[model samples]
Target: MLYLAGLAENSIVDGPGLRFTLFAQGCPHRCPGCQNPETWPFAGGQAAAPEQLVERIAQDPLVRGVTFSGGEPFAQAGEFARLGRLLRARGYEVACYTGYTFEQLFQNGNADQQALLHNLDVLVDGPFVQREQSLELAFRGSRNQRILDVPASLAAGRAVWVRARRWVLDEQPPEA
Candidate 1:
């Protein structure tokens, strides 16, 4: 069973390009200032089979890839690995967001989490640090977090940081 918070059919900011986003349920991190506080409890979301989610993602033709955001995808790592493998086999890239720092994950996640990490194209990791918050970071909320190139990290048996365009929240012109 998979605990899913929700799905965003098309999202541009979650990953490298336009993609479908799946927000999984259940996180233990409970980091302060988490934007999705509602997703903190494991019992708060709907449970579904992996095939159902895979089928839904497969049906979307316009999505270039899929982003698995969470309370923490590693919490449901087995499901993520299964779905990711299927998606990758179909030529779709998979990205994931996790609350664990790359080091922590490397040291503590279960076998399933490690497996899921292997299948992802990118991983945005680290618990949210409110004190270090930065709107300028791409795909992450704080300065301590990192955006990693997953396959490369796995191949090299270490984390490989990915460069992203800095988004300066202060510089954008006021929206009409």
Candidate 2:
């Protein structure tokens, strides 16, 4: 089961298109000036099965994608990975917001964490740095965060910037 702080249906701000956003409950990094500080506690939240979430997501036909926000989704990597796999099977684009860098996960994440990373299509990575916070960045709260192409990153064995026009402003991804 996955513990969730909340969920938003057809949320345009979470990703490129109208999407379902899951706010996971629980965090290791309680970054200062976080937008969702209430989610920092791991103990209190609604517990949901992956299958049940899939059904809930199905109710929204207009949702083109889904994003896993946090309270550190990596904290419940096994369950999130299950949900991600199910979403992928149903042709839903899956993205994730993580406090941990792609390199951190690639090198140090546990089995389930790695599985979850492998399942994602895109990942917005890095802890929210209040000093580097920006109102101008698209789909990210801080300058240090990156919108990554998961497949490319995995294939190249390094963090790779997403090239999708909707997700990035640059014509070409910067070198990894």
Candidate 3:
């Protein structure tokens, strides 16, 4: 079961294309200026089975993908990994927002967190930095946070910034 703060459907601001965004239930980072403070309590929010969440996503045919926002998605990496893998199997794109940097996820994340990383197409990584806050960054709250191309970054063994796909709100994604 996964703890979640909320879910947003048909959300354009969450990621590329209309997405189902899951705000996780608990967090330890407690980053200053967090957009969702209510998500901080580890015990808050109802628990949801991974399959049930995927089933909810499956009902929306127009949704291009899903974004796992957080109380910290990595906090329950194994369950989210299961959800990520299931979403991929259903032919939907997967993206995740994390307080942990990609390097930290790779080096220090548990087995499930690292596994979940493999299932992601995109990763919005790093904690929100109040000082690095930017109104200009696409899909990020702060300059220190990055929109990373997960598969390519994993393949290259380093974080790879996605230059071409960087988009402001309402831009259409490139066709495959």
Candidate 4:
């Protein structure tokens, strides 16, 4: 019984290139000024089978990957891990968004949470700090958040931030 808040198909902003984004339900970190406040309660979302979600994502040939965003995905870490493994086996890159900092997730998460983190290619971590909110930030709501390269960060035993400067291309080229 997976709790899914919603699904967005063909999303370019959620991850690198195009992606199928799943917004999971239930976040304990009810961080102030959260955009998706409706997703805060565990029971607010409808139950979905992992295979059903996977099938939906598989149908989209243009999708380069899948991004799991949420009311904190770590709350549903075990199910997310299962889904991530299945997606990875089908050659889909996985990304996730979480309220917990990388250090907190590493030190305090359950085995399933740890496994889920390991399966992801990229992770956008840290809770939204309203004071740090900046529209200029890439793929995150606040300055304190980070975009991590999961595999490299894990191997090096530290947080390795992936800068998103490449995606900010200028369309007009300043009239050159």
Best by lDDT: 2
List clashing residue pairs in candidate 2.
none
Report lDDT (Cα) of residue 77, candidate 2.
Answer: 99
Please give, for residues 75-167, the per-residue lDDT of candidate 4 as tens digits: 999999999988988999899999998888887889999999888888888999999998866577887777787888788778886544433
Q: Give lDDT tens digits, candidate 3, residues 1-176.
A: 99889989889887878899999999999999998999999986988999999999989899978999988999999999999999999899899999999999987878999999998988988999999997866688987777777888898888886555444342433221
| RMSD (CA, Å), each prediction | 5.4, 1.2, 3.7, 5.0
Q: How accurate is candidate 2 locally (lDDT)?
A: 0.93
Each model's TM-score, in the order given?
0.88, 0.97, 0.91, 0.90
Best model per TM-score: 2
Off by over 4 Å in 1: 163-176
C-alpha positional error of residue 120 in candidate 2 after TM-score superposition, expressed in Å: 0.4
**Candidates 1 and 4: which is better by TM-score?**
4
lDDT of 2 at 95: 98
Candidate 1, residue 99: the lDDT equals: 90
lDDT of 1 by residue, 148-173 (tens): 87877777777877543332222332
RMSD of 1: 5.4
**Model 1 per-residue lDDT at 90:** 86
Residue 67, candidate 4: C-alpha displacement in angstroms: 0.6
